[model samples]
Structure formats: C-alpha cells, structure tokens
Target: MSETYLIDRATVLTMDGATGATPVERSIRVHDGEIVAVAGALDPQPDDVVLSGRDRLVVPGYVNAHTHSWEALFRARLDNLPLEHWMLLSYPVLGLAPLSPDLIRLRSQLVAIESLRNGVTTLVDDVLEIPGQTEDQLAAVFEAYRDSGIRANISGHVMDRPFADHFPFLADALDADLRRQLDAVTVVRGDEYLDYARGSAQRYADYAGGRLRFMLGPSAPQRCSPDLLAGIDEIAATYDLEFHIHVLETRTQAVTGAEFYGKTMVEYLDALGVLNERVTMAHGIWVTDSDVEVLADRRASVSHNPISNLKLGSGIAPWRKYLDAGVNLGIGTDGMSSSDTARMSEAVKAAALLHKVTGPDYRQWPTAQEVLTAGTLGGARSARLGDTVGSVEVGKRADLVFYDMNSLAFTPRNKPELHLVYSENGSSIDTVMVDGRIVVRDGRVTSVDERAVLDELQARGPELRRWQDELETLNRALLPAFDRQYASVMARQVAVDRYSGRGECWLN
Candidate 1:
C-alpha cells in the first residue's frame, strides 16, 4: 500500500473533460497510485501526508506524444539541416556500431530525468536501433524506465526496406559504390520484427504495473514496404496495442508519396486499411485537406511536433485543419538532437503560438487552454492510455505536476493557463508526482543518482563523439549524391506548398 497524500486547497485543472473551462480551488486525495477523490476540501487521515497547496497550481502532468529518446546522447549535435539530410548522419545505414547495453540504459535514464524535470509524466518513445534491434538493448531501456518511475510507451521502430528507398532518384544520383553500399546493408525481415514484438509483449505485458507499455512503431510509410506496413497493423490488432508511425513530414516525403503510390501517404495507409483509431501519425505536415479528412474520419490522431518540424525546416503542420476536422491532436519534442530537450512546456508554448502565422484570423489561433489540453489529454488519447492517465479525476493515475505560483513565471498571474503556456518553461515546477510516487521534489529526481549519471556521460562524451564521427564520415561520403537527390526532389512541383515562403522557390 502506498502512502496517501492530501493536496489541500490548490488551484486544480482537472482536465477531466467534464471540468469547467477554468481551474477551481480543490483538494485531491491519492492512494495506491490512483486519485481517490477530488473536491473543495479533503480532511487528512492520521496516516496521510498533508501537503499545503497555498501558492501552488496543480495540473495534469504533460505528455510528450512523440520522441526519439535514444538520441538523447547526441542531442543538438546536428542542426540547420532538413530531416532527409540530417537523418543520414544521425541514422546512418551502415558503419555505425550498436550502442552498448549499459550506454542504452544510461541514455534512457537521461531522457526520463529530463522529462520528469520538465513535468512530463508520460511519453511515447519510438526507439530506432538503427543497425538492428536486440533483446539485451531492449531490456536495458525497459530497466531504465522501470527504475526511473516515469510512465512510458516504448516500441521498436520497424522498416523492412533498404534505406535508399527513401530517395526515389537514388540510383541516378548516387555512384555505383554508394548504391552497392546501401544494398549491402541488412534489413530485418517483417516477420522477424513481428516475432520479436510478440515475444517482447508477452515478456513485459504487465511490466511495472502498467507504468510501461510496448507499442508498434513503423518507421514511416515511405521507408516501409506495403507488406511490412500491413504486417505491423496485423500485429497491433493481435496484441491490442497502439501503433505509432511517421506520416508526410516534409515536401520530399509528399513527393515520395506521389511517385511511389500515386497518392498521399495518408491515402496509401487508408487504402491498406491501417489508418484507424489505433494509429498515431507523427508530424502530419505536408498533407492535403483530403488527408486531414481521412485522418479525422478514421479517428486517428496526429502527434504534432512543431519544434522539430521548424528545426528540420520540415514546415508547419495543418494545425487548424486537424482541430477543425476533429482530429485528435497531440504535441511532441521529436528527438533530443532535433528539439534538444524533452521539455513539454516548450512544445506546448510553440503549439499555442505557432499557428497564428497561418492567417490573420485571431479567432483560429489556439488558446492556452487548448494547447495545454493537447499536451496532456490529447497525448494520452493518441497513445491509447486516455482512460488511465492524463487527468486528475478519480480512477485516473496520479500523474500531477505542482507549479509554484510564487515563481517568477507565475508572478501576478491573471490566468494560470496563460502563464503556463506563455511564461513557464518548467522552472516553476515544484513537485512532480507520477503513479502516486514522488519522483521529483524540490526539482530533483528521487529514483536514481542523477548527478552520477551526468558524471558518467560527461566522462564518456569524447568516446561517444569519436564513435559518432566514424559513422558520420561513412554517411558524409554520400552527401554529394544526397545533395543531388534533394535538389531534384525540391525542383519537382508538389500539389501542396507547406513552406512559409510559398511563392518563392528557395532552391534557386
């Protein structure tokens, strides 16, 4: 039995769907990792721990709907590059050695630490092992999440096609040697990955008492074969798991869809009967209005990654279209190297403000409350964990973030949601509790030795960089080929223009 907690007289934003538009003064009771009661007042029992919430604002903990946590070790290492070119170096098809199991555990812990510090209690990690997936490495990630006490939905990113398939003109643009190099790279069979997922699901089905869930992650539509995509969907159905995948993120991807399938990637998925409620598409940019309609009609969700999309020059997603079409929306930080942090506050702010540039209609701009809801409840729904987490109502998991209203971010606060979306950036977070466990108090993690973890990473920085450089060198050798491919794709006209400078052809 866990210790009962009584948070008394705090401003609570329940986010329970039935709550009012604004927060109200309420006390919450928690025991056995669940919220037992919420009301105007709660009397503490003799064995209960009473916490005064006089100057605190309690809200549902943020959720990072999409992220590549394994890239934490090399965060912000590559910048000013588009998704296509950037991933070549970060996710090289060849010559990159697999990270040691110990290092994988350490990196996963780092992601959890940063996420907790940022008030993100739940996150969906699309783990891409690059060269291949292994049981030992997967176990290391699971161990880190279990020990760190943060709820996480993890998946092995699966793609059964050669990396070169992403570029339609690869054969013409690349030299024979480079083409052969790509061909020589081994890709696991679709059935093999399915088997692995099944084995892992059975092994960790009830892991950490629902604190951890194994999900299906297809790398992306263009990077995967049709059969593999279907197979993944089938596996998801068999296991009753939510599946996450990347959709049209960039102009190049939109072009790939037209050239490969003679339709949009969203339509391709729909044709395959896989774009349903169980699917969560990351970075649904470079999509058409019809694509948005399909997503909404199918009851699928979109994990909007504004920060990463901007960083990668992937262009802004159809924020208004998604919302207006009734598409369930979620926000994410993307990856450590892309957004450089696991902070949900930053993502929430971006989601709240970035859509204003779409047009002069201020009415269409996202409100602070809307973005905050997307960052929490919308994310939980996208991950298929809506009924369990993402709210402060009774029967929901006790994932709560208490913000110090006395902090500078909340000084003279008029609207708590506005302050949170416009001013707070995780610094105002005083305590973060997940699953009725105090994982963070006074801005420090209680689960693991954070300082020791940082020290080990600092000591190993040089070695990791050296190993990364070796892989970069191999990938960089094909830069000229990729450069040509990128130019050729950009030169071709796509149906939709998602870039900010729509009229101008920047390639010239």
Candidate 2:
C-alpha cells in the first residue's frame, strides 16, 4: 500500500536545477515514492509518517556515477601497484576465475550495503567480469540491489579476446576446463552486445517499474572493436538509455590507440559516432585539451574517480579542463578493489583537492559547492536521471540524506555545504531515504540483515583470496614461457623493421 511521509523543520539543500540558487528551510511531503510538496503551510494528515529533522541537514542522496561492484569482495588485495601492472596482475586473478553465483551475490550485497549506508542511493556499476556469465549472475546483483533498497544501473562486461595475447601467463595458466568455458562463449559484439543491453534494460525496467535502470557499457575502446561500439551507441539511442565506456584511463592506452588507429582514441570514437550527450566516459585521466573540447561539443559527461586514479598511480584527471570546456562531470569511487572505500564524501573532497594540486592557483580550485554538485547532481546528469533523482525538491523522488549537524565534524558549522564536502564523512549520515522510504536510519540499514551480510563476506573472503593467490602463483610460474613468446614477437618485429629500413624508431 502507498503511504505519505512528512519530514519537517530541516534546512534543505535542494539541489534542484531550478532551485539550487535558493533553497529554503521547509517541510517536505512525500506521497508514495514521489515528493508531493515542499512548503511551510501544509498541514499534516492523520496517517502521515512524520520524521523530525531537529539539528539535521537534509540534502540529496549521493549518486555514485560509476563503480565495479563485483570487485568489492577483492578490496585491499592489489594495493601499491601501477595501473598497468594492477590490471595485468589483478584483473585476471580477481575477475577471470570461475566464481560461484553465491559469492557474486554476496559481494553485490556487500557493495550495495556499503553504498546505502554511506548515503548513496544510486549506482551505475560496470560489472565486466566474464562475458556470457551475465544471466543468473547479473540477476543476483540486481536482487542484492533490490534487497539493499538501492537503485542501480547494471551492465555485463564484454571483452572480445582471449587473455593469452594481453596477459600471456595469465592466459596459459587457465585450466582446460576454464579455457573451454571462455572459448566456447560467444563474444558480445555488434548486434549481440546491443541485443544483450536492450534485453537487460527492458527486463530491469519492468522489475523496477522504472526505478532500477540499465545501461550499455562497451568496456573500453581497447576491449571493444569498432563495430561493437557503434552498435552499442545505436542500441542506447534506440532504447533511450545511457551509454558508458572507459576512455583515456592511462597513457599507454592512448598511445596504443593512436599507433594502431592512426588517430587519438577520442577522435577514433568520435569518428565512429559514439560520442554524444547520452554517453558518460569513465576515468578520462589522460584526456587532452582537444579531447575535452570534443567531449564538450558532443555534450558528453566525464566521471572523475580521484581515489582510484591515485591508488593506481594514474595521473590526475584534468578537472579544470573539463569544467572550462563545459563538460558535464561527476564523481565516482571506481570500485572497492581499486578505491578501497565507497565513501562519496571523501571522493568529493579528493576531487576538490586533486584539482588544487594540479591547477596553477588555489583561488581557481574547485569549491565545496562545486564538488558537492558533481557528486550529486552531476552524477544524476551522467545517469540521465538529473531531473528526477539528483536533487531534493517538490515533485521529485524523495531521495535524500540526513546528516547530524551536532557531530564534532560539523561543530559550529559556519557553512553547512562546506562542512558536508570538506569535513563530514559517511559517518555523519544519520539517515538515508530512497523513493520516499527510509533505507537507513540512525546509521543502520533497515532493509537487510547487516550482521549476516558481514558474516558471509568474512567467511567468503578467505576462499576467494586463496583462489586469487593460486592464480597469481600459476601466472608467475608461466612468466618465463611468456617472456620467450614475447621475445619471439619482438624479434620478428625487429626483422620487419630492419628490412623496411625503419630501424629502432619503427616500433615507436
């Protein structure tokens, strides 16, 4: 049955695009799942649920613009590694193995719980573990999101190549059974990728009644061929869905793309007609000024994952460039394994501070308000849900977070917005509401058995770790053979270079 709730006497930070400039302290009345009123004159009805907002600040619930929730269970396992090595050493070890559906479901639940507890109501996660493992595994993830009382945009990861060419040792170490499973699977490309994305969207659209959305993630330019990318864009447009892809995450990727495609990665994608308003590019760490201009021209969005970039030693993203170019931007934690935490408030501060370090003048640094907007509204914009979910306002979904203003972090708060961005972390989130329902109250999640989820995560950690360790050891053992194979390839390349009279610079 539908219900009505009135949250009164709160200083609301209505991030509404129309009302962002002037937010007033008022009572918000939510009917069913949508906000019906935001005024002082409304009288409470007899059956309405009234929540007191004494000494609390109400703001829009955070939107985690991007994540890889499947990596949540693998946190802290690959710390202190460079970006290339992290992907080389950790991706296969953590992702390529045959994980039980139970483990995947548990990990998704843990990740969703972490997000909800921290005041994040929506997540657009890139779950690209293994191709064709999408059906039951993805359903399990959606079930976790539903049970956790969070909204999500989930997509299966698609890759078109065997690991041997990229991570030779990792490929060779895969058992015949695993190899057969991988090889026999049909690659998601062209119409296949489109069909999968559209089907998933329709299914989840029905499941959420439009609450839980689905997106088309093409993995990245390197992982996807041109035909697949074009098809993905077409599919998203046809279905009116959001499109996500990784771009310019590292210099190696950019250099490789330029060398292979005779154009920059962004330019290549632009030529393929994949850049548009509906597209959100994750990472974008190594984007050039021209690239930023192209994105701006296309009205595309950029997801700034400051912690993940720093953790992996990827260069800081050009936040100022994007802002100057008028590119819509948002904040993300990337993934638990890459970020080690799912705290969006910390991510907001990181975004502000990272720009301060890279920019020439501190005065030009991103402000707390700007960072907060990026985390909430910008993320909503990236997900194409800006009008509905990003802000606290009348006639919108009642997605909000309540922070205890009495906390030490917010003591004598001169600027509540500043305190939220720079001082208050997730611990200050006293209550969280999504779709007018209180999913978290008094810092405790109300939807799931928190202790049992924690216990399951703890119990499952060791087995996953053991499997990862075994895979790493096997990869190490096969490294010598891979080295020989690489040497052979290099020798052949050198011979071709010599015959062509291109000399040492030929490879470059």
Candidate 3:
C-alpha cells in the first residue's frame, strides 16, 4: 500500500467542471494512489509524508489525447512538406526501418520524459506496424511507459495498405514488385488486433493496477476498408473499449473520398456504423457542418491538433462550428515529426490564437481558461478516462502537477489559470505526480535515467537517420515517374478552388 502524503501550501485548481473557476489555496491528501480529501489545510496523519508546495500551482496532470511516440526519432525530417508529401515521403521510410527493441524503448522513454517534464501524466499512443515489428519490441515501449510512471492508452495501428490511395506520390512511387508487396501485406483482422491490444492492456493493467488501457485504433477511413472499419467497431463494442481514428485531416482526403464513395470520409464511416460515443477522431480539420452535426448527434469526440495541422499545411479545424454544434472537442499534439513539440501549454495558446484569428470577432474567442479546460478535461473525456483522471477531487486518482510560481514568466501573476495557459511553458513544472507517486521532482524525471536515455538516443539516432535517408533516396530516385503519375491523378481527382472562399487559408 502506498503511504499517505500531504501536499500543503499550494493553489489547488480542482477543475471539477461545474464552473470555470480559479484555483483555491488548499492542501491535498493522498493515500493508496487516490486523493482522499482536499481542504483549506488538512492535518497530516501520523504516517503521512508532508511535501512543501509553497508558491506553486497544483492542478490535474495534462492528458495527451493523440500521439505517436515512435516518430520522435524523425524530428526535423518532414519540415516544409505539404500534408500529402510529408506522409508519402516520411511515413513509409520510418515504417520500413529496422528499429531494435532497445532503440524503440529508448525513443519511447525519451518521449515519456518530454511529456513528464511538461506535466502530461497520460498519453494515448497511436502506434501502427507493431505486429510485423516483434512483440518484444512493442513490449519495450510498454516497459518505458511503466518506468516513466505515467498512464497510457496504447493502440495498435491496423491498416490494410502500407500507403493509402490518398498519398498519390507514394502510391505511384512504388515499383510493380514493391506495389505487389505493399498490396500483399496483410494486417491482423479487427478481432485479432483487439485480442493483441487487449492482451497487452491486461498485462500492463495488472502490472500497473489499471494505469494502462487499450483502445481500438483503426488507421482511418482511407487506410481501412468498409469491412475492416465495421469489424473494428464490432470488436470495440465487444470489448467495451474506446476507438480512435484519423478523420478528414486534409482537403485532399475529403475530395478523394467524395470522388470514390460519393460521400465525405465522415459519411462513409458513419454509413459503416463506426461513429459513436466510444469513437474519437483526430484532426477533423476538413469536417463539414453536416459532419459536425453528425458527430454531435452521435456524441463522438474530436481531437484538434492545431500545431500539427498548421505545420503540415492542413487547414484549420472549425473550432467554433464544433463548439457551437455541441460537439465534444479536445486537443492533441499529433506527433513529434509533425508538431515538433509535445508541450500542451503551447497547444492551449495556439488553440486560443487560432480561434481568435479565424473567428468573426476576437472578443468572442476562446479564453485561456477555456482552452486549458479543453486540454485537460476535454482531452480526458475524448480518451474516455474523464471520470478517473481528468480533474482533482476526492475519489479520483492523484495525478497532479506542481508548477513553481517563482518563474520569471509568471512573476506578476494576476490570474494563475490564465497565466498558466498563456504565459507559462514546461519549465515552470517543478513536480509531476501520477497516481500519487512522484514521477518527476525538482524539474527532473525520477523514474528513469533521463540523461542516459538521451545519450543512447543521440548515439544511435544517426543509424536510424541513415536508414531513413536510404529509403528517402530510393523514393527520390523514382520521383520523376511519381511526379508524372501525381500530375495525371491530380488532374483527374483533385478539385482546385473548392475552398477558395473559406477565408485566406491562413494555415499556410
């Protein structure tokens, strides 16, 4: 049993969701990894360990709704590429490389450390290509999460094709034999994928006492056939698990799907009976008003990755449309290769600014407090872990972060919540506790040897880069043929000026 701990003298932001309120100075009591009570000043029990929290803001740890930790090694490689080119050029290269279990574990550990330092206690890792890649290699990732002492919802990527048809360049770049190999690649059936995911989740759930959960991650409408999507939905229903899928990320995707299926991607998924409360779609940037209405009607959640969308030249998501339509909305850092950073506070600020610039009036924009709530509670809700870990309160897991108030950025703190969302960054986080355990203290990770991990990653990262570069060179060698094929396909498929009136396309 964990010992009782008393965290005193801090401004506690309960985030109970009843009101958009400020943090109250109070003491929090934790026992057996659960918050037992919170008061203005709780008396420490005989067995309680008292921790000083002077001049600090204590709030529930941030939840990262969408992420791909393996992409950390591919940082700075996909810069300046459009959405289609980036995926076509980068994903296949990274996916084909020989990443050892040690390297995979190391990369995941680095990502966990980055999140811990930023006060993110929970992560939803959207992992693909785990089956062909050895089980031991995948287990290494789980081990890293355990060692980091953070909760995770790990999903195995289930895709039938190596590259979807939406990626015309990559599709056209494949030679006849390579194309056959890509077509011959078979993913685990939805039932089989669920079995693997459940086994992994149960192992980690028992090991960490339910700190880890599994979700059904269908690799989007384009990558998945109708039968596969339906199978995934049925499996999720059978296991009572949450489901995640990438939806309507680019105009190209929407256009391609419309041309193929005579409906938008969201409509296609809906026809297959995949949209539901248990489903969360990442990057609904191309969603139409009717799509938003369907999502709201079905009570499905959407994760808005503002940084990633902007970085990939994907258009801005209709934040006001989702919010006004009563759709559940959350925030995510899509992946390291796309977003370049995993800082949630920065995401919050970007969300606010994105809305302000896109909306009809700046005065009616989402405030810092509202964006912070979306990052915290809304994100947890999207992951279906809201009741347990989203907020600070009695009967909830004691996943909390303590930020030092003495930072130069927060010197003249008029409003702690506002300053936290708007002015502060990860450096202000002095301590991070997940499930009542201090995973990070004094601005350093405690569960793993972070410096050693960084050293190993830095040493071995070049080899990974070499492998990636080799793949890129192979692809570049075939670029001329690919360019001609892409031109023909775009001329026949892509709809130019479809979004001509949708504001100045500030995303680019």
Model number with the top lDDT: 1
Q: Could you give candidate 3's per-residue lDDT for residues 116-163 as a string of tens digits?
A: 899899898886644344467668777888888998887766775455
What order do candidates take by lDDT, descending?
1, 3, 2
Put down candidate 1 lDDT per residue, 1-508, tens digits, no spaces: 4799999999988887777337789999999989999999988889789988899999999889999977897786898898888888878777877888999999999999999999999989999997888999888989999999999999988888888887777779989988999999998898898889889878888999978989989999988888888888887887777789999899899889988999989999999989888899999888888888999999999999989998999998878888989999999999998888899899999888888887788898888767988999999999998998888899999999999999999989788878988999999889999999999999899998999999999999999999888888888888888889888888877777688613233443
lDDT of 2 by residue, 262-371 (tens): 66678888999889999999988766567879999999999999999888776677777788789999999998888988778778888878777653677778877678
Estimate the overall C-alpha local distance difference test score of candidate 2.
0.76
Local distance difference test scores for all models: 0.88, 0.76, 0.77
Of models 1 and 3, which has the larger TM-score?
A: 1
Q: Candidate 2, residue 437: CA error in Å?
A: 1.0
Which residues of candidate 1, in runs, are more than 4 Å off?
A: 501-508
lDDT of 2 at 403: 89
Model 3 scores worst on lDDT over the 10 consecutive residues at 496-505
TM-score of each: 0.97, 0.88, 0.91
